[model samples]
Target: MNAREEILRRLGETPAEPAAYAAIPRPYLRRHHEGDAVELFAERAADYRAEVRRIPGADLPAVLGALRGHYVVPDGLPADWTAGADVVRDDPPVSIAALDALDGVITGCAVAIAETGTVVLDHGPGQGRRALTLVPDHHVVVVESARIAADVPEALERLSPDRPLTFISGPSATSDIELSRVEGVHGPRRLTIVITD
Candidate 1:
């Protein structure tokens, strides 16, 4: 019999034993100390070669100015948050392409998973479209401790299935046959996450 038919035949002969499926061991859960989210995020980002920064809400303007590039696409970010930067509107048909041509992308995150050091984006207002972050060479994500979760499951619980979500662990990279790592293979070469209190 073919592989598919053989599998079906085996299934037909098997009894529905609940304990048979329960042989797998439960996953070990890690416990994080309180007040360690920010530190854990920084540590994980650094491990992945992403630059991490901490800034006050008011100093956001200054941080944007420091990043190189004449064009800046602020994803669904607030007007005041991008007042000084050159803003790209979403009305134009080529807006997505235009954003891809920009120097970098900046946006707010829906959640930050401390255990994985991952940032989750839901494309919410001031967060902009997913393409804005995907095509850029650099991505600067703003995360707040209030929205940081201790683990992936906790972060997933906060997200809805209806939204288009993007989870970023670090800068985009892939290894070649020679075992050399190449950055910016499919996404941004540089990733910077700024955590605010």
Candidate 2:
């Protein structure tokens, strides 16, 4: 037989077997450990270089008002929250340049993950649209204690799949080849998370 005929005959004689795939052993631990969710969240969030404050509900409005500089607040934020600072209501959709010029954006999170020290925003009520949060140089987030989840899985369970979610662990930063760190490359350089009771 010619070389091509010989090779084809050999290939036809070979067995055709389906490859077997071994199932990976996934030891999915639901939670890492047990601890006070709020305290753990504060501690973990602090470790990420984020300012975490446990504020009482009574002091929230005052604290928000006290936040220095001009800030853009979402449409549905409580009327009593601000105490006559240079606060602008983003009713008519603030321009991107306007948002960038503002001092920071104040928002309330949809859920907080204690284990990962993450603040998740669904852009609901007090939380403005995505641009309002991203364009500013600073971001001040207010998270309620009751909304803090024990872990990531728990947090996921709390959030709706359809909404636009932003998960922030710490300030925006990056490291270069020489290990030099730079802040505010893409997002806010400063992040302050206020955990309210």
Candidate 3:
């Protein structure tokens, strides 16, 4: 080895022990308001211009029937949820062109936050890949009442940190300088949330 390389190698070989990280104090509140997570979530979701519908588990078939166009769903979705509707299952992951041509997409969320009206998907069972939801013009999200949380922290606690998470508050929209609202800019133009008990 050269003299300079040997000297550099010797200098780099320090026997320093790793230090333990200090625990940071958590002073923030977990939840601010506490009434009904379902109610709060519905209210906030509506405020974001998303159509929120409440239905019983048994009525899913009827509600889905009213939705128009060619429907697509994740492979992990329950068979009974689709009922008699002709649905294209995304088992092999559809292309962007295919998803765009579809009328709408149906997905089940990992968790719903009442405080922020946010629905989170972790690409888990029933919730398809990110592109499946993004490319479609209409998105139908089914959220069980039992999976609702009061705040972000509660929702985060229930989700796995390593999973790919998608948090959606409302339909994709943007406004021009004169405040002319435009919908379906980068994501779905319409978001329909069905809350089930």
TM-scores for all candidates: the values are: 0.77, 0.83, 0.86
Rank all candidate structures by their lDDT, best first, as comma-separated numbers. 3, 2, 1
RMSD, every candidate, angstroms: 5.6, 9.2, 6.3
User: Which tens-of-lDDT digit does each residue in 113-152 have in candidate 1?
Assistant: 8888899988887676767777878888878778888877
lDDT of 2 at 169: 90
**RMSD in Å for candidate 2, one decimal?**
9.2
Better of 1 and 3 by lDDT: 3
Candidate 3: tens digits of C-alpha lDDT, residues 1-197? 99999999988987444342124455789897789999999999999999999999999978887787888999799888888676899978788899989999999999999999989999999998899889999999999999999998889879987899999999999999999999999899999999999
What does the lDDT come to for candidate 1? 0.77
Q: After superposition, which runs of candidate 1 have C-alpha atoms over 4 Å from their true positions?
A: 1-35, 72-75
Which residue pairs overlap in candidate 1's backbone? Answer: 75-128, 76-126, 76-127, 76-128, 77-126
Worst window of 10 by summed lDDT in candidate 2: 17-26
Better of 1 and 3 by TM-score: 3
Give lDDT per model, in order: 0.77, 0.87, 0.91
TM-score, structure 1 vs. true: 0.77
